[model samples]
Target: MQNQTETYMRRALELAKRGAGHVSPNPMVGCVIVKDGRIIGEGWHEYCGGLHAERNALKNCTEDPAGADLYVTLEPCCHWGRTPPCTDAILEKRIGRVFVGCLDANPLVAGKGAQILRDAGIPVETGICEDECRRLNEVFFHYITNKTPYVVLKYAMTLDGKIAAYTGDSRWVTGEAARRHVHETRAQLSGIMVGVGTVLTDDPLLTCRIEGGRNPYRIICDSHARTPLDCQLIRTAHEIDTVIAVTEWNERAAALKKAGAHLVLCQAKNDKVDLTDLMHQLGAHGLDSILLEGGAELAFAALEAGIVHKVQAYIAPKLIGGAAAKTPLGGTGFAKMADAMPLKNVTVTPLGEDFLIEGVL
Candidate 1:
């Protein structure tokens, strides 16, 4: 028989998915209330500054739940921020037991919630499906530890490993399914980033078009402030957030600023934008997860800086080989094969005619 802890934790994980694209700088959490082996209530963190998972679940539980067990994907928050402390709610409800999938890494709540429950004479069991729970809030974990947004580098390439043709024509490399999948990905992250080369060549709007997906903030790494003022991103900046990362001030800075782009100035090395500085700035702005779609140079820089936590590559079956074709990564690549990046816990899924390869580095 499946462990009851696992069953309830899995349900909580599913519930947490509803909060994607809405919770930023805060971990996604889900709660399930079970009484006499039957679920009585469920809830998830919906958005920033909104009611948390525990409170939401308690609100939905209309029955007498004094002896019910609560299953939570993440540790219940013990300190107050946007709302009341979840620990206090659990105490008042007289919950009989608690199952925690993972401990909260935030300094304010780290293991304190579980301690409070135990001190209140309530039984608390932790580490149920711990790895899965941590993976779900990987960006929040990274931010709490490193003070930077978790970076994910994603791109679509051909069988020959080229991102663009020699002539820079890359409208549709992957199938429609893969493209739709990319839109879903964009909707889940806090921001989408690309280099100036991609912005100039592709003129992408970088908005989420999926039915239920939310558009993330768009970011451009343009060292010289060269983003065209008339581009789609510039034109739509007033409606959505757009950030322009530049290494030096240029003549077009005032014009781009007037176009509603927030300019972030960072130092340049070898006449290139410093990826590390950009990441720090992004973290300070409360972006806990960032998706990097690139024109090669940016991907290589992120990889070189050791900041890319995950990589998603969509590979089409067709072959397009040319000496000048742009590859997915560009920079001073490693000199030896042993120095190449290694991926673990890899997953390969077929998306229509293309294959989606994803893993952690």
Candidate 2:
């Protein structure tokens, strides 16, 4: 029975991923109905303000789901949201048993969903594939629990940790596969951020280019509102959500605002926009997570503020040796090796000629 529960929970997790890029500020939940050791129905949360996974699965069941085992990646919601409570559907279906991947971190539901089923005489088993379920909704969980946005710092560099040549030429630092992967990742997160230097140099559009992929907000860390009015981000600001984090509302800031940019004033740290304040501000705007695609200085400032929760380092196989070459992290680092930040739960994946190393900070 334990093995069967895990099997169904794994399937639920897989289905939940289908909701990526569609659900934000809401968890991507998947549900499966099973009876007599055979699968009967399966569905995932399709979009924000849409029917939940449990309802979709129950509604789509070809046969009667009454007295069947129900497995869901998240605890079926018990409180009213944009849609009706998932617990209502599960109870109405008269499910025999319930298997949950993890209890929702949301205070409105949390453990209440499972308890509601238990109160109704339904046996509910939780914590099946719990870690995977939590990781799947890390952004939502962080935002709901911390009242701030989850931050991921991503950068591409050579094996020697150099992001650019001695002459500051950084074109094609990583292979095409790595770049494509970054674009796909951007689609999942709520926003992508970079420093003014990146805008001034690369003039990147920062929109998700994949067909059918949702575009994330383009956020620039320009303390003085120095983002060029003619840059790609400014040019497309009317089309895509563009935000400029500034320390003051000067003429430059007003000009960018007039040029279709959204401006947020954040406290300055190290004479740059303070990322902690920026995350909280963005969170208030309903952004659950941000992908920090940076120039080294902004990356370093974010890390120093202890706001960067995750890191994705794409390392090219080739070497670019130069003392003057730029590294992925700038600013004055820790005073000693022992003071350096370390990553946990690290993972490495090969991406063509480059490798991706990711971990929680």
lDDT of model number 2: 0.91
Tell me the lDDT of model 2 at 225: 87
For each candidate, the alpha-carbon lDDT, in order, equals 0.91, 0.91
Q: How far is 102's C-alpha from truth in model 2 (Å)?
A: 0.5
Model 1, poorest ten-residue lDDT window? 1-10
TM-score of 1: 0.97
lDDT per residue for candidate 1 within 1-361, as digits (tens), equals 2487799899999998889878877889999999998899899999989999988998999687799999999999999798989999999999999999999999998999999999999999999899999999988899998888898999999999988789988878998999999999898899999999988988999999989888898999999999999999999999989999998887797789988999999889678888899899999888888999996888998899888999999999999899999999998889999999999989999999999999998
Give per-residue CA lDDT, model 2, range 1-361, as digits (tens): 6777888999999999999989887889999999888899999999998999999999889899989999999999998879898888888888899999999889998899999999999999889999999999988889999988899999999989899999989888999999999988999999999999999988899989888888999999999988999999999999999999999989999999999999999998778888888888999999998999888888988888888999999999989899999998998888999988999989999999789999998
lDDT comparing candidate 1 with the true structure: 0.91
> What residue runs in model 1 are displaced by over 4 Å at the alpha carbon?
none
Off by over 4 Å in 2: none
Lowest summed lDDT across 10 adjacent residues in model 2 is found at: 268-277
TM-score per candidate, chains pooled: 0.97, 0.98
